[model samples]
Target: MTQGLAAAGCEVTLLLKAPVKTDRLVAPLTGVPGVTLRRPYEEELLPDLGPRGLTPDQAVGLITRLDTENRFDLVVVRGRRAAIAAAQAEALAGRLWTYLTDVPQNVAELTSAAVSELTDIAVASRFLLCQTEELRDFLESSVPAACGKSVLFPPVVVVPEGVAGSGTPHTPLKLVYTGKFAPRWNTLEMTELPAALAAQGVPAELHMIGDKIHRDSPDWAKRMAKALEDTPDLVWHGGQSRAEALRLSAQCDIGLSWRAPEMDASLELSTKVLELGALGLPVVLNRTPMHEELLGADYPLYAGEDIDSVADVLALAADPDVYRRAAERCAAASAKFTLDRAAERLRGYLDLAFPAAPAGTSPDRPLRVVVAGHDLKFFTRLADHLMSLPGLEVRLDEWEALRTHDQYRSKELAAWADVVICEWCGPNALFYAQHKRPGQRLLVRLHRFELYAEWPRKLDIDKVDAVICVSPYYADLTRERVGWPADKIVVLPNWVDDEQLDRPKLAGAEYTLGMIGIAPSRKRIDRGLDVLAALRRRDPRYTLVVKTKQPWDYWWIWNRPEEREYYERTYRRIQRSDLLADGVVFDPFGPDVATWLRRIGFVISTSDDESFHLAPAEGAASGGVPAVLAWPGADTIYSRRWVHEDTDAMADAIHRIVSEGRFDAARAAARAEITEHYALRRVCQLWTDLVVDGTAPERIQLDRFAAVGLG
Candidate 1:
C-alpha cells in the first residue's frame, strides 16, 4: 500500500522496528519516487532499550510525537490496533479519514479493536461492503452508536511476494498449501487428502509452508510423515522462507486452503486463497461460510466432510481443460482485488472524509501529531513533554490494552488528531502504513531491535516521514543497515518525569541488585545469572533480587513447549540455588520505581543490546548505582557512550558502590542528573521546535469541514 501510494505521487514515510536489514519488501520501496522510509529502532543500532514490547503509555507518547512531525494525506491500516492507533493519532492531529482492510467476518469476536478505530471502513469486495451494514447495526446495538462511513471495494493485490508464473505445465499434478500451519488451518488433517490421492494413482503431491506445531509434539511431524510414508511421491516439505515458499507454490498446479471447523477458522478467509487465485492457480478449499461468501456458489471444487471427497476433487482437477477453466476463473476473480482498485476506493473514501482545499487557500492550523509504538515509558515521558509545548497540543494514543480487550474494530476517539508518532519498526509496522489519516503528520521513532530481525524486512519504508532515534549510535546503525537517508533521521533520547523519581531509599538496600523489563533474549537474564555466579564467588554475602512480570510464554503466540520448558527450568534453578549463600529472590510484581529504589542498592544492565537503558537510568534516579556492561553496539554511533567493555572495570564499579556504603548519596545525585536531562518539559520543547518549525511548511492540508459530503 505504501508503494502504491508512492506510485500515486504521495510522499511516503515508513517507520519500522529495530535491526532493519535488506529483504524483498525493502528492495521495491527503496528508490521509489517520493517515498522516505525510516526505521529508528534497528537492534544493531540501539543497544540501550530492551525488547520490543510496548506499554500503553509508551504507545500513546510515540503517536503524539509522530503526529507533530509531518503531514500525511490519509492513514490506512490492516490490523485493528493499528487502525485505532492511527485514528487516535489522527484525532490528535485533528485530521480525519482512515482505511481498513480485511472483511468483517475475518475479525474475531475477540479482536474487534480494528473496526472500532476506523473513521471509515474499507473492504476488499462489494460483498464485504454489504456486510458492513450488519456490522454497523451490531455496533449501534452492541455499543452506543456507530459513526463514520464504511465502503466496500476490491482487495489490494501485489505482485506475488515469492512466486512467479511457471508458464509451463507438468504431467504430475502438484498441490500446494501456503500460510501459517496453525491448528485452525488443519494442515495435518489435510495430509489424509494427499495420501488418498496418491493411493488412488493420481499424480498428486502436498507441499506445506509455515508449520506452527510444537516441535516437541512427537506425533506432530510423524502424523504427516506416516500418511505419506507408503507413497514416495507424496512430499511434506517443511517450512520455507516466504520467497522460497512462493516460488515453490507457483510451480504447483493447484492451491489449497483447508480449515478445521473451529469458529475462527470457519469465518476467516486466508490470504493464501486470494494470493493463489491471484497467481492464476485453481484453489481447492474446504466448504465454509467464508469460502461461499468470497467465491460464490458458482465456484467449483469445494471439499466435502472427508478426505475422500478432496481426493476425488483433485482427480477431477488433473484434467487439463477443467484446470484451465478454473485457472481462468481465478485470474478473473483476482482482478477484483488488485492494489489499484483498493487504492481507488481508499481515494474515494478520503475524498468523502476530507473535502478538497479551496482554491488559493493555505492551511494555517498547527500541524497535529500522533505517535504509535510498543514502548510505554518512552512515549509517556515524550507525551508529557509534548503537551507542555507552547504552540502544540499533544494527546497520547494507546491501542494495545484497548485492542487486547476490544478485538480489532473501530475506535471513536481518533477522529480529531492530526499527526501520529510510532516506534516505526516491528512485526506490525506495515499495519500503520496501511491505515493513516488523510493530511496528517506521521512521525516514527526507530529503536534498535527491529534492525536485525525479519519483521522490518517486510516494511515499505517509503511510507514514513521523519524518524526520531534515541541516540546517534542508533541513527548511524539504522542508516548503515537499512540504507535510509541521514537527512530524514533525528536524534531524540527518551525522556522521563522528575516527580516520578522522588522515592526515598530503604535501609539494607545494599543487599539487592535489580534488573527490569522482560524478554529473556534481549535482557540476557541468563547472562545476568552468570554475572551473579561470578559475584557470589567474589563475595558470599551478596544476593540477587530480579523483578519481572510474566514472560512471553504465558501468551498463546509464544506458547511453544520448548520455550515453556526453558523458562520453567531456569526459574526453578534461580529459586532453588544458594550460589551466594544469602539466596535469590524473585518478585513477579514489584513496586514502582520509587518504591523499588528504596530496596535496591544497585541496578545491573546485562542486556546484549538496547535503544536506551531506561531501567538503569531510572534506577539511577532512584539512587541505585548503575552497573552496565558494554553492549555489543555500544561502540557504534547509536548506543550509549557510557558503556565500559572491561569486565574488571564493571566488577570494580560494582565493588566500589557496594563497599563504600554510598548508596543514598549516589541515588540522590543520579536522580538530580536524570531529572534535569530527561524532564518532560525540556523534551516537549524540543518536540515543538521539531514539529512546528522543522516539517510544518511542507504540509498539504485539506479542509475537512468544507469538503465533507462531496464524494
Candidate 2:
C-alpha cells in the first residue's frame, strides 16, 4: 500500500518502530528509492502498543514529541490501536487518514472517535464500503464531519519478466499456496489436499511457498511441520519474497487461495488471488461475490470447503484446452489490476483528501524548460513546438556524450531549468532526478526498453515529478517494474511529422507490405514471414519489404549465441518457405524512411511484445494501412480493427484491403488517423497543457481514428 502511495508521486515517510532484522524475506521497501524510513520513535511504548496500547494522554504526548522534531503534512495509519493513537494526537487533527481492511469488533467506536481528526477513511476492498456505511452515516449525522472514503487493493503484484516455465500436467498434478499458516486459515486442510487426491488415484503434489515456521506461532509451526511430514509429496519452501513466490507459482498447475472466513466472512480481498493471476496461473479459491467481481460470475474454477473439493476442481485441468482457457482468464483478470492503474485510482482519492501543493517557478523569470535525453529523434518536432511557445525558453541537451569525451553538464542545466523533461530513462534522468534543485519540476520520459532494464530500479522516483510513457501499455508495465508513482506517469504519444510521413503512394504499392526493426526475437520477423507466406499463396504480387540494418550489423544484438541461433533459424524458415523467392524483399538501412514506407501500401507489426511500435504508426502516416499483430497492449494503442491475432488474420486483413477496391480509402483513413491523433502540433499542444497549464494528464484526450462511408 505504501508502494502504491510512493508511486502515486507522494512524499512518503515509513515511520518504523525499530530497525529489527528477522527471518522474513528482504522487503523491496526496506530501502526503497523514493521513501524515507524514520526510526527511534519513543520505543518505551512498544511493548504496551501490542495489547495495552497507549492511553489518550500518552498517545498525544508520544506523537507530539515526534511531530515537534519533524512535522508532517499528512499522517496515514492503520489498525485499531494506531488509528486511536493518531486520532488522539490533536496537534495533527484533520490530517489523520485511517485505512481500514476488515470490520473488527468496536470498529464503530474507532470510527466515531477518529471522525473529528480524520481527513478521510479508506478500505482495502469495495465490500467494506457497504459494510461500513452505517458507521460512516453515523459520523456524518452526529459529528457533521465529511467522512470521505475510497477502496485501494494491494499494489499490483508484478510478475518477473523471466522465461516463463512450461510443463504439461500429467497424472500427478501440482498445486501451490502462499500466505501465512495461521490456525484460522485452515492450513491443515490445505496441506492435506495432495494426499486426498492421491487416494482418488490422482497423484498430486502440494508446494507450499510460505513460512510455516514463525517465532510468533511456535505451536502452530510444529503442527504444520508434522502435517507436512505426514502428508506425502509436500514441499514446504519456508519463506520467499513475493517476486520469488510468484515466479515459482508460474510452473504450478493450479494456485490455492482458499482461505477460511475468520474475518469479514471472506468478503475482503485475498492478495494470493492477484499474485496467481499476475503470473497467468489459474486459482481454486472459495466462491464469493468479491471473487465474482474480480474474475467474473461465469469463471469456471470455483472451489468449496475441504481438500477434496479443490482437488476435484483442479482434476479437470488435466485437459490441456481447459487449462489453457483458465490461464487466459487469469491473465485477463490480472491485467485490469496493474500497480499503475491502482496507484492512479488512489491518487484521485488522495486529491479529494489532500490537494497537491502548486508546482511552479517565480513569475519574474520565463518558464525555463530543458529537454534532455539519449534519444532525441522522437522529440525533434516537439522541441520545435516548445521553442515556438511564448513565455517559455526550451533548451535541448543530448547525452550521447556520456559514453565518450563529451561530458554531461547536468549541474549547470539543472540550475537553469524550472522544468526538465528527460527524453529517455538514461543518465540524464538519473542525474536530474538525484541533483534537481528545490522548486524545479522534473519529468522523465520512458519508452519500452527502459522497463526491462535496470535503470528503472535505480531511479530516485521521489525527485521526479513525472515519467511520461509513449503509451498506456508502457506506463502500466513501467509502474509495476519501476515502482514509480502511477499518478506521476503520464502517457504521451510520440510526435509524428506530417511533412515526413504524408506522401504519395506508388502504383502496385498496394501489394507490398513493410516491416522495420527485425533484429532481436521480440520483433517476431518469423511471424511476419508466416503472414507473408499466407498472403503470397493467395497472390504472388504480395511481397514483404523489410528495412533494417542486417541481422549481423549490430554485434551487440547478434553476437549473443542465442540471438545468432534465432537469426539463423529464422533464415532457415524463410528459405524453406520460399518467402525469399518472390515473396520477400530486404532493403538495407537508409535515411529515406518515408520514401521506403510509401513504396508499400500495407504495414505490419509482428513483435511478440512491445511498449509502442513506431513502424506501424509511421507506415500509416506514410499512406499504408497498418495491420499490427496483437502484442502486449497493442490493441489499446492501435485501433481494435487494425490489430490482428495471428498470421491468418493479418493475411486476411491485407487481402481484404487490396481485393475489395478499398486501398485508396484505407490508405487515406490511415493517414488521417496519424494527422489527427499523432500529428506534431496536436501532440505538442497536449504536452504544453500538461506541463504549463497544470491540467491533469488524464484530462487531455487525443483524436480517434475513423473511416468515412466505409460501412
lDDT of each: 0.56, 0.69
Residue 69, model 1: lDDT of 79
Model 1 Cα lDDT, one tens digit per residue, 355-422: 43322223565445555554555466456445533345555555464123221321321345566666
Best TM-score among the predictions, by candidate number? 2
Off by over 4 Å in 2: 1-365, 400-408, 699-711
lDDT of 2 by residue, 83-137 (tens): 6565555676656655554333343544644544332232211111221222333
Clashes of each: 129, 3
In the predicted model 2, the residue pairs found to clash are 7-484, 7-485, 8-485
